[model samples]
Target: MEIGNKEDNRGYWDIVWNPPGERTGIFDVIKGTEFRIIYHDESQAEVSFTRTWDPSLEGKAVPLNIDKRFIILRGSSGFYTYGIYEHKEGWPDFGLEETRVAFKLRKDKFHYMALADNRQRIMPMPDDRLPPRGQQLAYPEAVLLVDPINPDLRGEVDDKYQYSCEDQYNNVHGWVSFDPPIGFWQITPSDESRTGGPLKQNLTSHVGPTMLAMFLSAHYAGGDLSPKFTDGEYWKKVHGPVFMYLNSSWDGSDPTMLWEDAKVQMMIEKESWPYVFALSEDFQKTEQRGCVSGRLLVRDRYIDDQDLYASGAYVGLALPGEAGSWQRECKGYQFWCRADVDGSFYIRNIVTGNYNLYAWVPGFIGDYKLDATLTIASGDDIYLGDLVYEPPRDGPTIWEIGVPDRSAAEFYVPDPNPNYVNRLYIDHPDRFRQYGLWERYAELYPDGDLVYTIDQSDYSTDWFYAQVNRRTDQNTYQPTTWQIKFNLDSVSPNSTYKFRVALASSTLAELQVLSKERKKDLAFSYLHPSFFLSNVITGNSSCMINVLAQVFFNDQDKGVPHFTTGLIGRDNAIARHGIHGLYWLFNIDVGSAWLVQGLNTIYLKQARSTSPFQGLMYDYLRLEGPCGC
Candidate 1:
């Protein structure tokens, strides 16, 4: 279907897909079966297109029905579109790897793409990615524009994945046409129907003069995020009602102003969520939705005796499962809100259902899950009084490193190699997204691993962002050990200590605790020095297994790890140039006998060394002395 002002060829945009080659099958195509008008009035109009699955074509086509809808209100500057995907109870089993709605703009007209204020730039033409002009890099998605129509982009890298952003900030992004001074924007009002949580990264606008409304994708989070149906299970979901907005300079203003205008329009759409104009019963109206409100307070006695307001806390309700299930939940809707300065939050327009309230406050180490399930009915305004979150803490803090904000952005990120730079992030805040930073770890520490002293070292400068493998030779990598040194004036032999660590991201990696009594000999505690665990959570479903990290004291093997993060996560945040993938917390108990009065050290080793990408990023680490010590 055509969109935008048809009279002006520059504004014309269409939904297009590549025709399947000879090897393509019927299931690959979204064949439209029927189209009909749902309603028509002076105020608004709605239409639906249904693609029903045929039993006769079961072996060849996907066993499902797909319904797509579009709506436009009078005097509106944009239109809304949504879709429904369903599979019958007796349908054949299949897996949905990826699904998204894409729009191809007029290539000649839209030359500049804007993802964020600092991320917007004139993009390379589609032809620039061709052989003679471009040279392929590690993957086909990445290419070096060796020779481009515009000499400025020459010697720069062009990768669509480089422009990915978290779902929280992916509100409005599109292309700006300079000739006629027009903009084509895609605006997502809410993420309730999305798969991963707020931090999940997905693609946005890229070259080819393209814009996308991502619904389900395996871009950052791998196979776990892909939904698979087995035994003909009945399933259905509403993808979106995202807005396609168009704007132009009315008084001969700069075309770039359209981006700011689109941002303002985005807020307007967000405020009008649960749009009342949709005719489908499946799309709930404002009256059919509910609101949840409460105040969140945190009590970490080590920080203060009185409860502190959990300001800027991320509070949300999702399908009840576990304390941190919200990040991996893909089947249902989620409603999230940020707590205000006084720790107050008001989550509105949530679809009626049973949910568990989940929250994580900045500067805290663990997640908080409400004890009771909340049930919301139509027009229900539920108020849960004061809720308190006591973060995981066992004693007074001896020392701590880094922040507990579920991100490794606070750590030191090295500059990218000059030969392989993106140029856009040379001095940008997101310098962590640069390509080939993993190899820098080996270069910075050619002879030994990282060593940090409690009072003398600064985490911002001394601590590396990720614990990557050290390249021994060409095509070979080996695990590395980092040391943390601390001192105590006196030690209580009968007390127990708490060693807490939080990881912001992990990928096919395992953490092992080793002890070194004299700094000369390597000693093992629980597992024998020759013992090894074969598999890890690789994020690839076909080849996944449980992985673990251990802890030790004074280079003494404590029989078993005080704690082990068995089979944690597979978010490949390191290679993606992201600060975090998934959040994980572990609290270990250390025997006081392992501590000496003067000098003590703890060694943390990442056991996985097969690939440069196998590593983990620490969010925060702390060692707490026993209470009343």
Candidate 2:
């Protein structure tokens, strides 16, 4: 089938048919009849073609062998184009035709029309013709082109819509509207887009795929992949010699060889100093002491020996490793042989402390002496110096000495027993009399356990105990006396015992009266005596008065008892025959005591009398031993 113009200059066409394969026998029978043409055009052109023939020469009015030709005028230019499309066998030969013409050439101006004879056959359509509005064209099933880089855009026109290169160029050129603004389209010198060129260099040297892959890995892993940069060592480790130049001359007047030799000597002396003498004093007396015993080997003999030693030298030493400050007991010292000699010596001791070492030889006005403060630990040998001693024109002799002071002693008091009573006697004879009485009573009944019978005979005023005067007027009641006794029978022999004694006025009214009179006394101003007893006994004995009573009374209250005048006594004792007046007694059998084998307590009591208004009534105490009756 042919659909478009064939040598038809008007750009119009018709369909004429010739079947693909020829038929024979009965099916090939006959065709020959009037035929008509049909066509369409974009410009509304009109045209037509027809034929009429008789087929009797083959005994059929429409003979199968009959063929015909017809013309379809297409345009006013008379240049109408048509197509011959064959639909069936010998259809063209049967005088059938179809034509098309541009609408510009037709008087009716209809853009599309159709014509045909009684036959039902229609003309074939050209593939290039535009479809009706909103109508889709049928496309081929197969794909033809493939692009690897942008495979999504590759295919036959039928399989995918063709994207116009013009549109792509316009979008890239910033001429057409795009949802996202177009970026710069970098071009090469040749005026072509540079999409295929290498991408811009990464400022951080992160450009290539490998670098990108590494970066992605680091980001995902959350750490750097490269090794960290570092400076290996932090602290410097120093060792070897420490060369200290003392009076060394800066000018070349002192040979370099001499200085170098001296430095080496200093190192040798530092090392050998400890072996010779452990202390500086040992080195100062002898040449074989400390490092001085080592030979002095001079490297520069040509240099003046006097100049080498006298040119304001420096002292130095070699250490095994880094050395800390010297410690206690150890010291460093140095001595030079002579001011003009080329040799000097150093002494290092394991002992530490401040030290001074000196060499005092005749004819040498300058004594080589060095004083060093050092604290050396055990096993430490410190180098002191290659001291250079210059001779003074004249001055006092420099002597080295070591003087150490003695350490103080440590003393502490041990615990004391609380049961033994201590007493002191002051200046008055009356006070001594009373105190001696108490003492005698304790000696007789030393076990501190004693009992007393208080009756008319015991109440005599003669031989009563009294105390002397004290300093203050307020407490000027004669001598201050205390009578304390303990029950030793209740206490074990050689065992410690404690007791406490307290004195209080028998009545508040009496205490007030006494306090009024003794308020100005020195004894009254001080704390009242509270006696404690601590003692160990040796044998069975009864309660005994172990403490003496003394008085410190002022001149104004001369011969008066320093304590308040009142009846003093311990509870739980035998009743005493006396006026309803105040009475004083010490009971030994009442309180607790610790007794051991062969030790017993003696019971005893001594009495004395005093009155706030009357002053001292008695001046003596009567002491009695344990009853053997």
Candidate 3:
């Protein structure tokens, strides 16, 4: 077959292999295949594929395009591209009789360890060419098309390194185009809109880049600059400007005016490049001063509510004696930051100074007391761990909502709305009387204490758990419910996790997880939610899996020693089948999306069953994982 054509009296062709089969492989064949090519000079040159597919094999190329020949191949050993040209008269390779083929090869540095779903593409292209048109430039061979309209000589492939061959690389030639910066730029004081710290080096969180290889990159790029080296190309040694570091931006509309020396000290100071910057007195003062940054965490009992101010509370940081006036006085409200849904907050870009942090909430009866003593210097980023409130809970008790008591089932909180939390269990509530009018549970606990609160629920699972008198009135059995709380933050992030909810009963009840968040996040609707599990439930055959466990389904089959009801005989009982009238278990999994930092409520509610006398009972809830869930 005709393989290549003349390009201004030059012939070119590039090859690629398959990927995803093996990191590297040896072809186990030799008998019949050969590379066949008919040249324009009415001459033929052939290379046999009869040998082991590798890089060491080299063969002569037909002198086509008048004075050039081609021998190109790739293998695990290394990539080889040879273009033998006439060395009738020359200095370098004057008798070597060749120029190199411009085809470029790239190595996949991290392919063996990557999973099939995670592996990247490997595509080879010609160094002196442009890639094929309309090709997505990523993977197997990620081609960078710099001057597409001008010329490109490399073809794009799905995976140029695939073991099978179906196409060839493209061919185009041109130089990358850009010019040196023009004119000049001056640093003028910007508007007050530029919000930053008291210092100029405080570039509002944009810090300097860090690396060491930059100063020696030119030597690394081409060793020809060294007297001991001579293999460097002539052009790389002759082109462009050089700097210890260079920062640039481009606008093709006027490439000539793209960049200029702004003369601004870019906050990129390095110990070795001290001579680069000459600062003024005011500029030096800014650099000498520092900033303070940290996260705020309250005691376990104190709810990290974001709208503390709206709730008649505020976290304050101020001078030590600022609040010691005849009347309590405080300043610097801008120094305060509210906590996030996760009870985490950050104070950024504060000028270095001494300060005290204190907070006051409506229900929490206390005067301002310093939670921390800050001594900040230039560029200081401080992080304070969990703060403990002295005597976390005290004074008269207050009730946020509902009747509070022990036991998982039968809660008194109403439904949750957007603004107000109806079912809230903040810390441990104590029974108290409010003004002798109504007796209520006081939501008083030491600050930062663990709190479990259910914010919403439907009435479907209620009467079954609440109607205790129904259990004795009717001959029919009543269903049961269990409510539990856990700190999801306790589970590490980016990990697999599993939990089991088990109930011991003479009969089985239809179990449902009541939390909307849990239903949407944790896998809950019957076992094997995904087809990846080897124990396929619906339509799955392959064993390769990426997802985690969808809950282990363990049914109760044998009779219990304590509550034995079913017959020991083989074929008599007609009541029990598929987890009915027995104790069963389901493993709940909260994959990756962890729980909030505080107390997270989990509810297990059971409904009425068809069994005659079997009563629904609660057993236990347990967590088992971070890895093998």
Best by lDDT: 1
lDDT for model 3, please: 0.25
* Backbone N/Cα/C clashes per model: 3, 96, 31
The estimated TM-scores of all candidates read 0.88, 0.12, 0.18
Question: Model 1: per-residue lDDT, tens digit, 1-629?
Answer: 12442433222212221112222222253545799999999989999888888788665666668888889999998888888888889777666656667777877789989988898889999889999999887668778888989898988888787789999999999999998898999999999888877878898988888788888765566556666667778888787899999999967898898999999999999998888888888888899999999999999988998999999999999988788778777767888989999899999998998999999999898889999899989999999989999998879999999999999999989988776778888899988878778889988999999998999999998999999899998788998878777888887777777777788887877776444432332333333211222221111111111123544333243354333444345677777778888777766666677666776776677877887888989999888888888
lDDT string, candidate 3, 587-619, tens digits: 345443434445544443334333332233232
Residue-level lDDT for 423 in candidate 2: 15
Global local distance difference test of model 2: 0.21
Residue 570 lDDT in candidate 1: 67
lDDT at residue 381 of model 2 (Cα atoms): 47
| Model 2 C-alpha lDDT per residue in residues 52-93, reported as the tens digit of each score | 333333222222222222222333111212212122232222
User: Which of 2 and 3 is the better model by TM-score?
Assistant: 3
User: What ordering of candidates by lDDT runs from best to worst?
Assistant: 1, 3, 2
Worst lDDT 10-window in candidate 2: 205-214
User: What's the residue-level lDDT of 176 in candidate 3?
Assistant: 13
